[model samples]
Target: MTARTARQRLRDDAGSAVVEFPLVAVLIILIALTLIQCALVVHTRNTLTDAAVQAAHTASLEGNEPEDGATRGAQLVHDRFGEDYAVEVDADEKGEGVVRVRITATFPLIGLIGPSGTLHVDGHAIDEETW
Candidate 1:
Protein backbone atom coordinates (compact mmCIF):
# COMPACT_ATOMS: atom_id res chain seq x y z
CA MET A 1 0.00 0.00 0.00
CA THR A 2 1.14 3.56 -0.73
CA ALA A 3 1.98 5.83 2.22
CA ARG A 4 -0.83 8.18 3.21
CA THR A 5 -0.52 11.89 2.45
CA ALA A 6 -0.79 14.59 5.15
CA ARG A 7 -4.08 15.87 3.67
CA GLN A 8 -5.57 12.40 3.57
CA ARG A 9 -4.58 11.71 7.21
CA LEU A 10 -6.09 15.03 8.31
CA ARG A 11 -9.42 14.26 6.64
CA ASP A 12 -9.57 10.82 8.32
CA ASP A 13 -9.01 12.32 11.74
CA ALA A 14 -11.80 14.90 11.39
CA GLY A 15 -14.87 12.74 12.08
CA SER A 16 -13.10 10.76 14.85
CA ALA A 17 -13.73 13.65 17.23
CA VAL A 18 -17.39 13.94 16.23
CA VAL A 19 -17.91 10.23 16.92
CA GLU A 20 -16.30 10.42 20.37
CA PHE A 21 -18.01 13.69 21.35
CA PRO A 22 -21.52 12.28 21.78
CA LEU A 23 -20.43 9.33 23.96
CA VAL A 24 -18.46 11.59 26.28
CA ALA A 25 -21.26 14.09 26.46
CA VAL A 26 -23.77 11.41 27.41
CA LEU A 27 -21.52 10.11 30.20
CA ILE A 28 -21.03 13.61 31.59
CA ILE A 29 -24.76 14.26 31.62
CA LEU A 30 -25.43 11.02 33.48
CA ILE A 31 -22.84 11.83 36.15
CA ALA A 32 -24.32 15.27 36.66
CA LEU A 33 -27.81 13.84 37.06
CA THR A 34 -26.60 11.31 39.62
CA LEU A 35 -24.95 14.09 41.62
CA ILE A 36 -28.15 16.10 41.56
CA GLN A 37 -30.11 13.12 42.89
CA CYS A 38 -27.65 12.76 45.77
CA ALA A 39 -28.10 16.42 46.64
CA LEU A 40 -31.85 15.96 46.64
CA VAL A 41 -31.55 13.08 49.09
CA VAL A 42 -29.44 15.20 51.44
CA HIS A 43 -31.95 18.03 51.24
CA THR A 44 -34.83 15.71 52.03
CA ARG A 45 -32.98 14.45 55.09
CA ASN A 46 -32.35 17.99 56.33
CA THR A 47 -36.00 18.90 55.91
CA LEU A 48 -37.06 15.87 57.94
CA THR A 49 -34.66 16.82 60.74
CA ASP A 50 -35.97 20.34 60.87
CA ALA A 51 -39.54 19.13 61.13
CA ALA A 52 -38.59 16.80 63.95
CA VAL A 53 -36.86 19.58 65.87
CA GLN A 54 -39.88 21.84 65.56
CA ALA A 55 -42.24 19.13 66.69
CA ALA A 56 -40.08 18.28 69.70
CA HIS A 57 -39.94 21.92 70.74
CA THR A 58 -43.68 22.28 70.44
CA ALA A 59 -44.38 19.14 72.46
CA SER A 60 -42.00 20.22 75.19
CA LEU A 61 -43.63 23.63 75.35
CA GLU A 62 -47.05 22.11 75.79
CA GLY A 63 -46.11 19.24 78.09
CA ASN A 64 -43.97 16.05 78.04
CA GLU A 65 -46.36 14.45 75.58
CA PRO A 66 -44.34 12.16 73.32
CA GLU A 67 -47.32 11.09 71.21
CA ASP A 68 -48.33 14.65 70.50
CA GLY A 69 -44.79 15.51 69.56
CA ALA A 70 -44.62 12.55 67.22
CA THR A 71 -47.93 13.40 65.61
CA ARG A 72 -46.82 16.94 64.95
CA GLY A 73 -43.52 15.83 63.52
CA ALA A 74 -45.16 13.23 61.32
CA GLN A 75 -47.64 15.75 60.09
CA LEU A 76 -44.88 18.02 58.93
CA VAL A 77 -43.21 15.15 57.15
CA HIS A 78 -46.46 14.21 55.46
CA ASP A 79 -46.90 17.77 54.31
CA ARG A 80 -43.63 17.58 52.46
CA PHE A 81 -43.48 13.99 51.26
CA GLY A 82 -47.21 13.23 51.23
CA GLU A 83 -49.28 10.95 53.43
CA ASP A 84 -48.17 7.84 51.55
CA TYR A 85 -44.81 7.88 53.30
CA ALA A 86 -44.09 6.16 56.58
CA VAL A 87 -43.44 8.11 59.78
CA GLU A 88 -42.57 6.99 63.28
CA VAL A 89 -41.85 9.02 66.42
CA ASP A 90 -40.59 8.18 69.89
CA ALA A 91 -39.27 10.07 72.89
CA ASP A 92 -36.02 9.46 74.70
CA GLU A 93 -35.65 8.87 78.43
CA LYS A 94 -37.05 11.51 80.69
CA GLY A 95 -34.37 14.30 81.01
CA GLU A 96 -32.74 13.63 77.69
CA GLY A 97 -35.22 16.01 76.14
CA VAL A 98 -34.89 14.35 72.80
CA VAL A 99 -37.27 12.80 70.28
CA ARG A 100 -36.73 10.49 67.32
CA VAL A 101 -38.59 10.73 64.05
CA ARG A 102 -38.19 8.36 61.14
CA ILE A 103 -39.49 9.04 57.66
CA THR A 104 -39.57 6.53 54.86
CA ALA A 105 -40.18 7.31 51.22
CA THR A 106 -40.99 4.92 48.43
CA PHE A 107 -40.11 6.22 45.03
CA PRO A 108 -39.29 4.87 41.63
CA LEU A 109 -35.67 4.96 40.48
CA ILE A 110 -36.33 4.09 36.86
CA GLY A 111 -38.92 2.44 34.68
CA LEU A 112 -40.59 -0.43 36.52
CA ILE A 113 -37.92 -0.38 39.22
CA GLY A 114 -37.59 1.33 42.56
CA PRO A 115 -36.31 1.21 46.14
CA SER A 116 -37.22 2.69 49.51
CA GLY A 117 -35.10 5.15 51.45
CA THR A 118 -35.60 6.10 55.08
CA LEU A 119 -34.64 9.40 56.65
CA HIS A 120 -34.22 9.46 60.41
CA VAL A 121 -34.05 12.72 62.31
CA ASP A 122 -33.20 12.91 66.01
CA GLY A 123 -34.16 16.21 67.55
CA HIS A 124 -33.02 17.08 71.06
CA ALA A 125 -35.09 19.93 72.35
CA ILE A 126 -34.34 19.27 75.98
CA ASP A 127 -35.11 22.16 78.30
CA GLU A 128 -31.98 24.01 79.38
CA GLU A 129 -33.03 23.68 82.99
CA THR A 130 -33.56 19.93 82.70
CA TRP A 131 -31.38 17.71 80.42
Candidate 2:
Protein backbone atom coordinates (compact mmCIF):
# COMPACT_ATOMS: atom_id res chain seq x y z
CA MET A 1 0.00 0.00 0.00
CA THR A 2 1.03 3.56 -0.60
CA ALA A 3 2.38 5.49 2.42
CA ARG A 4 -0.42 8.07 2.04
CA THR A 5 -3.05 5.32 2.02
CA ALA A 6 -1.48 3.70 5.08
CA ARG A 7 -1.48 7.06 6.91
CA GLN A 8 -5.12 7.60 5.97
CA ARG A 9 -6.07 4.16 7.34
CA LEU A 10 -4.16 4.91 10.54
CA ARG A 11 -6.07 8.17 10.89
CA ASP A 12 -9.37 6.37 10.44
CA ASP A 13 -8.44 3.91 13.18
CA ALA A 14 -7.12 6.58 15.52
CA GLY A 15 -9.23 7.30 18.63
CA SER A 16 -11.11 3.99 18.10
CA ALA A 17 -9.63 2.69 21.34
CA VAL A 18 -11.11 5.64 23.23
CA VAL A 19 -14.57 4.98 21.83
CA GLU A 20 -14.39 1.16 22.19
CA PHE A 21 -12.97 1.25 25.68
CA PRO A 22 -16.07 2.53 27.43
CA LEU A 23 -18.27 0.06 25.59
CA VAL A 24 -16.15 -2.94 26.53
CA ALA A 25 -15.54 -1.56 29.96
CA VAL A 26 -19.26 -1.20 30.55
CA LEU A 27 -19.85 -4.80 29.49
CA ILE A 28 -17.08 -6.05 31.74
CA ILE A 29 -18.35 -4.01 34.64
CA LEU A 30 -21.85 -5.36 34.21
CA ILE A 31 -20.56 -8.91 34.16
CA ALA A 32 -18.56 -8.29 37.28
CA LEU A 33 -21.56 -6.83 39.07
CA THR A 34 -23.70 -9.82 38.09
CA LEU A 35 -21.10 -12.26 39.40
CA ILE A 36 -20.78 -10.35 42.61
CA GLN A 37 -24.54 -10.32 43.10
CA CYS A 38 -24.69 -14.05 42.50
CA ALA A 39 -22.00 -14.61 45.09
CA LEU A 40 -23.86 -12.46 47.58
CA VAL A 41 -27.10 -14.32 47.02
CA VAL A 42 -25.42 -17.67 47.45
CA HIS A 43 -23.71 -16.50 50.59
CA THR A 44 -26.96 -15.23 52.03
CA ARG A 45 -28.74 -18.49 51.28
CA ASN A 46 -25.96 -20.50 52.90
CA THR A 47 -25.99 -18.30 55.95
CA LEU A 48 -29.73 -18.66 56.35
CA THR A 49 -29.52 -22.38 55.95
CA ASP A 50 -26.75 -22.62 58.52
CA ALA A 51 -28.77 -20.59 60.98
CA ALA A 52 -31.80 -22.78 60.51
CA VAL A 53 -29.82 -25.95 61.07
CA GLN A 54 -28.21 -24.59 64.19
CA ALA A 55 -31.58 -23.56 65.55
CA ALA A 56 -33.03 -26.97 64.92
CA HIS A 57 -30.13 -28.58 66.70
CA THR A 58 -30.57 -26.30 69.68
CA ALA A 59 -34.27 -26.94 69.89
CA SER A 60 -33.76 -30.68 69.73
CA LEU A 61 -31.95 -30.63 73.06
CA GLU A 62 -34.62 -32.45 75.08
CA GLY A 63 -36.06 -29.60 77.10
CA ASN A 64 -35.88 -26.85 74.47
CA GLU A 65 -39.04 -25.85 72.66
CA PRO A 66 -39.65 -25.15 68.99
CA GLU A 67 -40.04 -21.48 69.67
CA ASP A 68 -36.63 -21.44 71.26
CA GLY A 69 -35.09 -22.81 68.10
CA ALA A 70 -36.87 -20.27 65.97
CA THR A 71 -35.71 -17.46 68.20
CA ARG A 72 -32.15 -18.67 68.12
CA GLY A 73 -32.19 -18.88 64.35
CA ALA A 74 -33.57 -15.39 64.05
CA GLN A 75 -30.95 -14.05 66.40
CA LEU A 76 -28.19 -15.77 64.49
CA VAL A 77 -29.35 -14.28 61.21
CA HIS A 78 -29.75 -10.85 62.70
CA ASP A 79 -26.32 -10.98 64.27
CA ARG A 80 -24.57 -11.93 61.06
CA PHE A 81 -26.50 -9.89 58.54
CA GLY A 82 -27.80 -7.20 60.82
CA GLU A 83 -31.36 -5.93 60.33
CA ASP A 84 -31.06 -5.50 56.64
CA TYR A 85 -32.42 -8.96 56.01
CA ALA A 86 -36.06 -9.46 56.88
CA VAL A 87 -36.00 -13.01 58.21
CA GLU A 88 -38.69 -15.20 59.68
CA VAL A 89 -38.04 -18.46 61.46
CA ASP A 90 -40.47 -21.19 62.41
CA ALA A 91 -39.83 -24.51 64.09
CA ASP A 92 -42.06 -27.45 64.78
CA GLU A 93 -42.09 -31.19 65.24
CA LYS A 94 -42.18 -32.95 61.88
CA GLY A 95 -43.40 -36.36 62.97
CA GLU A 96 -41.26 -39.40 63.80
CA GLY A 97 -39.31 -37.54 66.48
CA VAL A 98 -37.87 -35.04 64.04
CA VAL A 99 -37.79 -31.28 64.49
CA ARG A 100 -37.90 -29.00 61.51
CA VAL A 101 -36.90 -25.37 61.31
CA ARG A 102 -38.00 -23.27 58.39
CA ILE A 103 -36.54 -19.93 57.45
CA THR A 104 -38.16 -17.53 55.01
CA ALA A 105 -36.60 -14.29 53.95
CA THR A 106 -36.04 -11.88 51.13
CA PHE A 107 -33.52 -13.03 48.56
CA PRO A 108 -30.98 -10.40 47.72
CA LEU A 109 -31.66 -9.16 44.24
CA ILE A 110 -29.66 -5.95 44.22
CA GLY A 111 -27.19 -4.89 46.82
CA LEU A 112 -28.73 -6.94 49.64
CA ILE A 113 -32.28 -5.80 48.97
CA GLY A 114 -34.98 -7.68 47.14
CA PRO A 115 -38.63 -8.69 47.08
CA SER A 116 -39.95 -10.34 50.22
CA GLY A 117 -40.60 -14.07 50.59
CA THR A 118 -38.21 -14.95 47.84
CA LEU A 119 -36.04 -17.31 49.89
CA HIS A 120 -36.98 -20.37 51.90
CA VAL A 121 -34.78 -22.89 53.69
CA ASP A 122 -35.47 -25.78 55.98
CA GLY A 123 -33.35 -27.54 58.61
CA HIS A 124 -34.15 -30.71 60.41
CA ALA A 125 -32.83 -32.53 63.46
CA ILE A 126 -33.87 -35.49 65.54
CA ASP A 127 -35.47 -34.62 68.84
CA GLU A 128 -33.22 -35.67 71.68
CA GLU A 129 -36.24 -36.94 73.59
CA THR A 130 -36.45 -39.75 71.07
CA TRP A 131 -32.92 -40.86 71.79
For model 2, what is the error of residue 43's alpha carbon versus the real structure, in angstroms, after optimal superposition?
A: 1.0
Q: Report the lDDT tens digits of candidate 1 across residue range 1-131.
A: 33567667877766788899999999999999788777766777788778878877766663556666777887888998788766776654364654444434443343223665555567756643353
- Which candidate wins on lDDT? 2
Which residue pairs does candidate 1 place in steric collision?
Answer: none
TM-score of each: 0.74, 0.86
Clashes of each: 0, 0
53 Cα displacement, candidate 1 (Å): 0.6
Q: What lDDT does model 2 reach?
A: 0.90
Q: What are the root-mean-square deviations of the candidates from the true structure over C-alphas? A: 3.8, 3.1
* Clashes by residue pair, model 2: none
Overall local distance difference test of candidate 1: 0.66
Where is the poorest 10-residue window by lDDT in model 1?
A: 104-113
Q: What local lDDT does model 1 show for residue 69?
A: 70
